[model samples]
Target: MEQELFTAQDLEELQRRGISLEEATQQVEDIRQGFPYLEILASASLEDGIISNEPSQEERYMSLWERYLERKDASVYKMVPASGAASRMFKMLFSFLDADYSEPRTEAERRFFDELHHFAFYELLNEACLRNHWKSIPKLLAQGDYKAVVETLLLPKGLGYGSKPKGLLLFHRYDKVERTALEEHFVEGALYARDSLGQVHLHFTISPEHQRDFESLVARVKDCYEEHYSVRYLVSFSQQEPATDTLALTPEGGLFRREDGSLLFRPGGHGSLIRNLNALDADIVFIKNIDNVVLDLYKGPTVMYKKYLGGVLVAIRDQVFGYLRQLDKGKVSHSQLEEMSAFMRDAFGIRLPEVLDDESLAPWLREKLNRPIRVCGMVRNEGEPGGGPFVIRETDGSSSLQILESSQINMADEGQRQFFEAGQYFNPVDLVCSLRDWQGKPFDLERYVNPKTAFIAHKSQVGRELLALERPGLWNGAMHDWNTAFVEVPLETFNPVKEVNDLLRPEHQA
Candidate 1:
């Protein structure tokens, strides 16, 4: 009977992972009941949840951010999610690696080989091929040994790029050198995240296996970037907590077990990085994906918009903190309370239910004001695959801004489907977040997570199909209960290298 759920060793393993018995029980229950579809009230637009500032307002916010950066005590840091292997980026190449045909077959495969030398990593891959196989790429092509070239780039005997993280892969070409996605992030951090102390702090969530490689890469380039930009670098790294790993379930919704009768667990997705973000002591935390960095020529707009978003955050935080202090001192008037409510509605996209009671207003304002605030940059929807910002009505009859994924929505519903399709803006995961309260205390970010927002995904391991659980996404349910704002940003500020071909785009080619 005990073995039906957990054995003694299983219990010990759960404890070691920091997962409580109650949490495990709840996860099993979730697999059984399934997560509820998010109710979409409407898609966030320029006239809805999104804020599109005028040229003058944009300038003012940029100036405010510059002034805020000049404050001696201000702290800002950039957080990048860079954990996963780059296996997906090499999906086509992997197919070629296993195919019966030795030469390139498909158009994609042909393009890869035809333009192989155009890649920033061309020289490196060529050198790896020669070093590992005693034949250069040109010689291999002359011999019609295309697989040899790919194997040299991907296999352990050579560059081993197929198993490497995207952050370490060469992405952009400069006149003097090639840069990885990680190095580009350092440049961007120096441009915008540097404080009055001339220090740029950055944290990356990376796979434990690649931590040393990432550290070495940073060590190799940190000094050069620091000297080039005249700024000090404070870099840090973290791995996903084993405790946040979710159990894999069988098709029958039972606990999945390996051949050794041990349970299978998978990483809990980017949402788990909330724990890493929570651990930072920064006042302003900028969250961006590791693969979203662009070439130096295209960084100006991205840097400007980053500062603009941060400026908006500081300006809003100042007003909210002042109102919270007034509420703390019991000096707030009825008119001031109304003004606060208006600010929440207009600035935060929070539509509260009608409340006439004066006593209840102070605590309510304090509760809302004391939470974390994030200004997410939304771009014009160009059919990119990511969560789109939406305004959803909560259980309390209030409505708040949220980033909802397709899996979370009931696409079967005509109205919800229409709203989803009608969305004009897209979430770029471009966020400028404030994690401190008015009293200068760090918020317990876990408290704001919406547990019901976890995802159930179908996956296969070793030819066995299973249902994997993913925690609420970092920008979606993890920050669900926080005050949210969406500001319109340029499309140029949102180039993400989702595919290897994307690197060939003009933005990355310099």
Candidate 2:
């Protein structure tokens, strides 16, 4: 009776995870009550929220960013979400292992086997095959033992890539060496995110299980990259806190439990990385996905555009900071307030609900300008599957630019679906974010998160159906209240390796 719904053991587990029993119980209640769909105003396009810069403006913005870097006043860091396992990349091959036939049956299977030699991991996998079956990949294939080669490549007897993170998997090939996705991030950080002090700080949000592997890989390769790039690299890692783990629901819509009778929790998705990002001691932080790396030949556009986005933020951030400071003086004229309002609308796509007196406007200016800001890279939709930029009406009656995923939108509403279909740009998770406010104080990022943006997902555990909650997405709900800006980036700058075969794409190949 004292514990009520939970046993004393359950309370102990909650304490171990830094989660309160009330929070845990409320999670179950929230899952049952469900999160409401966002109120949509319209899609963010070049005509409104998104900034479509001209080709000639590129030099100006890039130069502005270069000057910001040379100023050496603000520090920059890069945050990558790399904890995801590479199992999904090999989903097709996993099916092959269980199929009735030994030989390639599907077109994807044939393509994978045909292009196997072109993969960066080919030679290493071949060595693994030899060690496991006493035969090379070619010999194994000739002998009609494709599964054996796959087992050697995937299982512990070989590279163990099946259990490894994408960051550790070899993704690109060179004349003399191969580089993993993590290594590519090092190169990219040096190219764009480096500060004038010749330092580049990168933080990876990874799984605890993979920490030792990451450390070993970094120790073996960090020095070489630092020497080659002529810059010191400060690499760090953090596991998603167990406190951020959300409770899962059983198929029947009750609190889910494991076979051993312990409560079940799942990672709160990338949104949980916000806590990790908040811990960075940087003024500017670049966020990108781990699987978005490309060969050096294709990195020029990415590097250049990254600078351009940073420059855009630098210019806007300077203006916002200046306004915030001016408002602190409390003597801004009506004309000055009008200009501030115009800039807010033009630069940030924020519109106040109604007119206010100068006394009220000053505080409004300070409130709006003093917040975390992110310049997200939006690309032509090209019919990609991901969140897109939109202008959503806020609770305060103002409309702010946002990136909404399908799960966040109410597609059943015709008007909302029309707005959804109207969006032409896609969020590539390429962002240059300002982490500190005008007074040089870090923002308590959690204060800006829109909890209503959290998502419910269907999942399975040991043959039982379950529901998992993905905290408001990192780019979507987590940053919902931040000052948002969208910039168009090139389609070429958006290559992602969703599948293992995607490595065969020209962007991934050298």
Candidate 3:
């Protein structure tokens, strides 16, 4: 298929949108290179598809448990990408810092800052302001030193938000808590005993601007864990530039940008973490977001589910490796060979298994039947956060488990409507995959990756008034391959502090 060449008009439009001609040209080149698969994806259909409702076979679960028992010594690596700006959180802090102290700040602002000061954010400020010995905010502000006051009071000691990194946000839920988000992640690693077995390592990816803060956060976390958990830190940080187009106007109504022409915005979807995950040298890696940590009370069930998922992967790996071995030895029949190849595609593409009633042609040698994938819940929960699991047809006329973002669904279609209505959905929390089997063959991420669809985000400025806007996200325009799965964890495990009101909830502040 011929690649679509970017027209001069398109380039001009990008430049008008603040993308330089040089960068625009590079983006065009990248798109051209990644476009062929998208064309193939565009031609596919998911009509008359039925979601898989079958339960996992008892034997399969037992086999998974068995593998978990045997490989109790195997290590697990956790990677949290923490290089985001706390601009959103700090914007609220700025409201406190810039308040009319003589008249008194609003109750809402006072309460938030009270919690912020009680939480580790204040200690971070104390450390930063040590030279000035800021006994009082009035004293610091009296000197007409707004930057120093901000640096001392608001900024974490070594890191500046946007100027530093998001992971270093002085993230304590309460005054008594000394852990930041970075520390919390390490704490989980320690709880999992990741460092002890050398089986689990915690790695953080940060931008170059925040490298020192990243190191400092690592050191602090190491110190805390060593004294408390007897766990050494396996923490490491990788430096990468934040995506350039992720900027937006601050709530105070001014544009925020990094030194690199990039907008200070949310990490461009966790999908961007794929490249970094691929670059890691670990045998087994668990990819998760920075803010997804549950409080210590909820950690047990969450970790159990994580282990269950990993156990399943270990069992599946053995089966796949056995089949591969047979294929390599030429010991498989023609029918078996075809079946093995089909499984390889389905496993990697994460495609939904074929339904028996579907009109699609059935292969002669089906090694395994379809089963439902889920994060088994011990309790009913609130609404699911991440994309749901769906059976989606790919460009190659095959189907797999696709994490369904509502943006990916064309709501105009009736089939999609029914499909959406019928299935149980779960958030993509921590996932499990085995590094090696009894025979010691490595697990291939490419084997489980869906390579069909990629995204082309539309950058636009939409608003209700004359204010300028920037919206760059993977919503409707983000094209993802269909093999996705959603497994619901417990409600206690999902506490996201999206707004100041959210912190007031006992689950977060408590």
Q: Could you estimate the TM-score for every candidate?
A: 0.97, 0.97, 0.63
Question: What are the per-residue Cα lDDT tens digits for candidate 2 across 105-156?
Answer: 9999999999999999999898888777888889999989999988887777
lDDT score, residue 402, model 1? 97
Candidate 1: lDDT over CA atoms? 0.90
lDDT of each: 0.90, 0.90, 0.47
Tens-digit lDDT track for model 3 on 381-484?
Answer: 24654454455555555544444555456656666666555544444444543334335544333333333233334343433111122221121112132122
Q: Residue 248 lDDT in model 3?
A: 38
- For model 3, the stretches where C-alpha displacement exceeds 4 angstroms are 1-75, 90-164, 173-177, 193-199, 241-270, 331-386, 417-424, 434-452, 458-486
Backbone clash pairs for candidate 2 read none
lDDT of 3: 0.47
Off by over 4 Å in 2: 1-3
Poorest 10 consecutive residues by lDDT, candidate 1: 1-10
Report backbone clashes per prediction: 0, 0, 22
